[model samples]
Structure formats: structure tokens, C-alpha cells
Target: MKLQLAIDLEDIQGAIDLIQKTKDSIDIFEYGTPLVINFGLEGLKKIRAEFPDITLLADLKIMDVASYEVNQAFVYGADITTILGVAEDQSIKDAVKAAHEAGKELLVDMIGVQDIATRAREIDAFGADYIGTHTGYDLQALGQDPGGIKLTAAEEIKSANPDLLIIGGAISTVDDPATAAAEFKKLLG
Candidate 1:
């Protein structure tokens, strides 16, 4: 079980500082969609330079041009990059291939896919290292909890592909990330 700290701040320095402060508590540092969109690969480069030993995840939520996007993420020093579950199967395959070529991992983000079980099965067959069920910030703001769905999908994936990682991307939405992460670790245990 790994605790990933997702950073969505517009300020790269602030994100870096937070990662520096919370480095010991989390295993992976995720550069959220907003942070990636706001600063592009430059932000990832800076963080990689600052924390060379930490695992950095680029949450690009890539839906198309999988190879190019995944390659760019790895080239910029991301240890893991994300692909959208709603993307075409070919795109998912391409992303996985790119990740393999880069010697990194691809996490498939199931953010908007309505059929959780079916899509989870399908995406799990795509050979991604991790399958993540995410509840975006807007949904979290509306008080919607996706933990149940996330756990369900995780169970399904674990049954089908026990080695594949199951990621819950809503920890950042929780009030206390450290406590939430600890609870997740306990649950996994």
C-alpha cells in the first residue's frame, strides 16, 4: 500500500514546498491535472530536480495521443503517468507500451466511466500497472464520496489481476490526508 500526495496548486514552488514538508508521509507525489496544465512539463522538471529520489506521478489523464503524452511525461522525469479509462483500447495499449518503453508505470484513471465493474475489467486487461478510480474536485465539492465505488473497482481488479495496483485518487479531497492515507493503509493491510 502506497500513500500518494496529490498537489493541485497553481504555484510550483508551493507544491514543491508541500512535497518537501510531507515527503516522509507519502510514497508518491502526484502532480494533479491543474498543476500540470498550469505549468506544463517545466513543473515536473523542477520537482524532479528537487526530489530526485521520490516517485513522481504526472496525472495527465491522457485521453488521446497516448504514446506522445506518456513519452513526454517520462522524458520529463515522471515515474508514473496516467491514462484515462474512457480512452480507446488502442490508446490505452499505446500508453502501456510507452510506459514499458520508458521503464515507468501507467495508471489508468477511471474518472467519468459510468460502468465501473465492466470498465474496470476492460481496463484491467489493458496491462496498466495501476487502475485508479477518481472523484474529481467538483464531485468532491458536491459531497459525493467515490470511496465505495473505488473500493469495489479495486476488488474487481484485484480478483482479475492481483498484481496490478489499485489506486484511490480521492485522498486529496479528504479533510485530513495523513489520516485518510493511514486509514487506507490500514484497510489494505
Candidate 2:
């Protein structure tokens, strides 16, 4: 039931203000993919500086140069970093190792990856901290619901490794946190 607030858009200060106001209520703070792409690691560093106590996840959506990206994120104060499950197995392994070496966590983003079960199993073997059942913003904008998909992915990953932590993303509204938490509870039970 961890609530990760995704900060997207191009306004770093605006995002900082919102996070400053809401950080107490959220379990994790995420620098969204678009924001990271737009502002890079320095932007993530700024957010990290603002909230040193909070768990900061950088949604880098890393597809290549796994070690370098993960290292950069960790150095910039990211407690956790994300990698695409669709990426090469070597990349996933490298990133996972980098995360471990840096004392950080790795979140495998299972977005648009067809072999989710296989990838989940592989990530479990690599000891990823969490598996993110995520829907892209474009799909959400087109009215595709992520609840069911997230639940399904969570179930699949949990089956592979019951100890795995499942997180949901592309959750745009406030109501989504409760709904998703409830759904995840039911699935876990």
C-alpha cells in the first residue's frame, strides 16, 4: 500500500512545492520519466535535496547503459531507480548489481513488456526490490485503465516471488491511491 506520488511536467519548482506540501502523506516520491528526461539528473538531485528523508525513486526508464544510469542516479541521491523490463537481460543484471553496490533499490517497470512472467522471474533472481506495474501516460490519456493491468502484473510477479513488492503507476487522481491499494490488498490476500 505504498503511495508513490509521480512528479511529471516541466516545472521543477512547482513540483517541489507540491511535494513539500504532500510529502507527509505519501510513502514514496518519484521523479517521473518526463521530468527526468526534461531536467536530467540535476533536477532529481534538487528534489532529493528538498526531501532527504523521503524515499526518492528516479523514473529513468533506463533501456541501456544500465550501470552508468544507475550509478548516476544513486550518486544524485536516488534511493531507488527504475529500469524497463523489456530491456536486455544483461542490462537488467547490470542495473540490479549497480543498485546493490550503491545501497539503492531497483524497480523493474513492466510496461509494454510481453514476457512479464519471464522478466519478473529474472528480476526476482537478480533480487530487485520492487516490480512496478505501470501504464504509460499516453495510454492513460487514451482512457486505458491501469488498475486491472496492474493487479494482473502484480499477481504474476508475486507468483514468481511472493516476497516481491508491487507498486502501481500512471495513477493520476487522488482516488486512485485508495482504489489501487484496495485492489492490491485483495490480490495479495
Candidate 3:
């Protein structure tokens, strides 16, 4: 029942301000792909320094150089780093290993890939800590539904590996949080 608040499009100060404002209310604080790309790992470090207790997720959307990226993220204070589910098996394994070595978690983001079953299986095989069923900003902007992807991926992953963690994305509004929680419950059952 963790609620991760994604911070995107804002500058470092703005992100810091938002996190400071919402830290007590949110379970996890996510640095969105755009913000990470714009500010780099330093952005993650800054947020971590500001909020030491909150779980910090860096949405790097890593596709290659898995070990290096994971190491860099961990060094910069990311408690969890995200890689693309569509990435090569070796890449996923490398990232997962790196994350384990650093005592952090890896979240495999299933963005464009439609075959949730296969991707979830692959990520689970690699021992990823969490699977992110995400709707990218462009998709959300185009009025796409996040529930379909979230439910499909959650069900597929739970069927394959009941222990795996399923994280829903494109959740910003208050209503979406309740919707996501209900969808997760249905999938778990």
C-alpha cells in the first residue's frame, strides 16, 4: 500500500520544496525520468540529503550499462533505481546484482512493452525488487488509461511470482491513489 509521489518538470529547488512539503504524507519519493535526465544523479543526492527517512526512487529508465548506472545511482543516494523491462536479460541481471551489492532495490519499468507476462517473468528471473507498471508522460497526456496496464502487469507478475512487488505509475491525483489501491487489491486476489 505504498504511495510513491513522482516529481517531474520541476527544477532542483522546486523538487526539494515539493518533497519537503509532502514527505510526511508520501511513502516513497520518486525522481521522475525527465527530472533525472535534466539534473543527473546529483539531483537524487540532493533529495536524499534533504529527506533521509523517505525512500528515494530514481527513474533512470536505464537501458544499458546496467552496472555502471546502478552503481552511480547508489553512490548518489538512490535507495531504488529503475531499469527498462525491455532491456536485455544480461542488463537486468547486472543491474539487479549491482543493486544487491549496494544494498538497494531495482525497479524494472514496463513502459512501452505490452507483453507483461514475459517481461515480468524475465525481471523476476533477474531478481528485481519491484516491477513498475508505468504509463509514460506522453501516454498520460494523450489520455491513456493507467489502470489497464497496472492491473495486467500486477496480475501477470503475481501469477508468476507471488512475492514480487508491483508498483503502479501515472498516479498523481487523489482519486488515482484510491483507484490504484483498489486495482492492486483485485489483482492480488
Candidate 4:
């Protein structure tokens, strides 16, 4: 029931700028994978300093050293972080533990999971805070990826579950990011 805007822009300033523009409308602001790759956890520290109270998710998409990485993310001011569901079950458990200990959360991104139902139950048992389905989310579904499918599937997916959280990255590509976010908010409502 919240709008999470994924800021996959190149630099720190771009993330800050987009957050500034859409802050009022977007419920959660994400520091996407590219930002983490480009600026490291230092980028998250800077953004956290800028908007201390906003719900910020650092999409670390962790693959190894779950406890250390998840702890580092929280230390750098991430309210939520992620680990790939395709990772080892122990890694998933460790990430969830670290997130919970930090009073934060870990989203288990099911990008390449071969069997979603089996893994989802295991992830839930491991105490993951969220499960991210679809590859790179709506952007990929809308033909942004090589094997892309239609975005109409996003609506159908949403309609399937009442407890769903839909996060979008398309807002970052538009002329007016705030308007785009507001449109999503309206549509979700």
C-alpha cells in the first residue's frame, strides 16, 4: 500500500535530486544497485545524512557475506536492503538476522529463482522482510530487458495479492519525476 521509487540514476546528486522532486509523493526511496556499485556505501551515508527520516532502501542485492554486507548497509543508514533468493539458504538466514538485529529489513530478490513457491516459503521461514519478483521489476517487464514482457503483467500481478508492494524505476526516466510518481500513486489507489 506504498509507492517505492527506485532511483537507479548514475550518481549521488541525481539520486538526491530525484528524491527531492518526489519525496512528498513517494513513500520509500531506493538507492538502486547501480548507485551502490558506483558510489559504494559512502553514497548511502551521504544520502542518509541528507534525508535522515525518509524510508531508504539500499538495493545491495547481496550475494555473499550476508551478515557483513547487511550490517554494513544498516551502519551506512539503510532501512531496508536486499539479498538474492538464489543465494544459499544460510546466506538468506544470515541476512535476515542482520537486518532484524539492526531493526531493518532484507528483501529477497527472486530474480533468477528456479522455483518461486518453494523458495518463498523457505525465505519466509528465514524471516526475510520482502520478496521481489520479476526481473529488474516493471522496467524489464515493459520491454527494457532483452527477454522483456509486457507491463500489463505488473497490474495483473498486483491484483493477485492484497499484501503486495509495487516498486517502480520508470519515474527516474521521465521529464517530471514527481508527476510520474503521483500517477503511480493514483493508479495504485
Which has the greatest TM-score? Answer: 4
* Worst-scoring 10-residue span by lDDT in model 1: 161-170
Q: How accurate is candidate 4 locally (lDDT)?
A: 0.81
Model 2, TM vs. native? 0.77
* 61-146: candidate 2 lDDT, tens digit per residue: 99999999999999998989999998888999999999998888999899998777877888889888887766676787888865
State the C-alpha lDDT per candidate. 0.78, 0.75, 0.75, 0.81
TM of each candidate vs. truth: 0.79, 0.77, 0.77, 0.87
Give the per-residue lDDT digits (tens) of candidate 4, residues 82-131. Answer: 89999998999999998998889788889888798998998989888888
The candidate maximizing lDDT is 4
- Which model is ahead, 3 or 4, in terms of lDDT? 4
lDDT tens string, model 1, 3-34? 66678753889777667656665678888889
TM accuracy, model 1:
0.79
The runs of at least 3 residues in candidate 1 whose Cα sits more than 4 Å from the true structure, single-residue gaps closed, are 147-189
Lowest summed lDDT across 10 adjacent residues in model 2 is found at 166-175
Candidate 3, 1-189: lDDT as tens digits: 455667776788977876665555456678888888899888888888887888888889999999999989888888888999889899999999999999999999899889998889878888998887777767878888653235556656566553434343433333345455445545554
Report RMSD for candidate 2.
5.0
